[model samples]
Target: MIVTIAGAGHMARGIGNRTLAGGHTLRLYDRTRAKADELAASLGQAASGADVAAVDEGAVAGSDVVVLALPFPAGREVAAAWAGALEGKVVVDISNPVDFSTFDSLVVEPGTSAAEQIAAAAPGARVVKAFNTTFAGPLVTGEVAGRPLDVFVAGDDEAAKRTVSELVSSAGLRPLDVGPLRRARELEGFQFLHMASQERLGLNWSSGIAILP
Candidate 1:
């Protein structure tokens, strides 16, 4: 499986490392070509950098899955630009849509989510909402102590969710299916609280949301 990631930021690098380690080919694209090149260097032979427009659409064309690891606004733009190219492919939305200014709530309005908005923009693609609740540092590390990090996944399509779940598992994380697309509202809302808690409690990025039996 060839996995293409749109951003070379923390999240994209984390996912790319996991995907490449899992034996899949990885293509990464970023506005900063240097960042992509640096990441590809870190990832070795399985990873390479390319132009955003051409690489994004080309990855969708050649790969089974495409991960939009960018911020919400950027993800939307990419989805719109690659709408036709993303048809029949599983698009994973890992954005939280949080208002960084206040860190109080989601940038998306009530009853809607970033993932749903991306889905709306790319009607041809199957969108799955996931990875928003976890911090990038933990995602890259894959665990805190000895316990595997839990990744919550939600999507309109069960098959798409399954595909994402498999990727999560492949990355050495536990993927929990929280329900359908609408549940993304809950996930995003939960992320808002989680972010607030991190600041309020003065916890580092190492802090994570864990579900115990």
Candidate 2:
């Protein structure tokens, strides 16, 4: 499968690492070309023989899945800007809309999540909320403390959710389908608390949330 990830931040690199490990082709895009190129090179070095490259944002057209590894506002903006292009495509929103300055609450309005907003913006796209609860550090390895990371997936489209779940499994992680897109409200809220507790728990943002059977 071909995966296109936007944004060249830590989350982008982490997800790109897993995508390559899963043997899927990875195409990275960032507003700043240098950042994308740098991340692509870094991921390539870590995953030898991996198929990865830095490409223009337009390249998302050919991707099987397009990951918005960006922040809340940017994710929504990109979704809207590329709405037409994203039609019939599976779009993943992995942003946690926490208020960084306060770190006490989410930035989005009550009852709605960043993923929902992005979904509203890209009406035609199969928007799925995933990877929001997993921090970048643990995502790179897809595990923590010898346990696989649990990626909670929520979307209205069954086929799109299945596609994302398969990708999560292929990357050696667990995918938990937590109902429809509205479930994103809880996922975002859950991750907000997880992010808030990081410092108190002294997790160093390296913790992974796993569901034990």
Residue-level lDDT of model 2, residues 1-213, one tens digit each, is: 999999999999889988988899999999999999999999999988999999998898999999999999999999999999999999999998899999989999989989889999999999999999989999878998999899999999999999999999999999999999999999999888988898899889998776789
What count of clashes does model 2 give?
Answer: 0
Task: Give me the candidate number with maximum TM-score.
Answer: 2
| 1-213: candidate 1 lDDT, tens digit per residue | 667888888888777777765666678777676777777777774434422222434556887788899998999999999999888889999898889998878899999999889999999899998888888787666787668888889998999999989888987888999999889999989888888888678988776687876
TM-score of each: 0.91, 0.98
What overall lDDT goes with each candidate model? 0.82, 0.93
Model 2 segments more than 4 A misplaced: none
Index of the highest-lDDT prediction: 2
**Candidate 2 overall Cα lDDT vs. reference?**
0.93
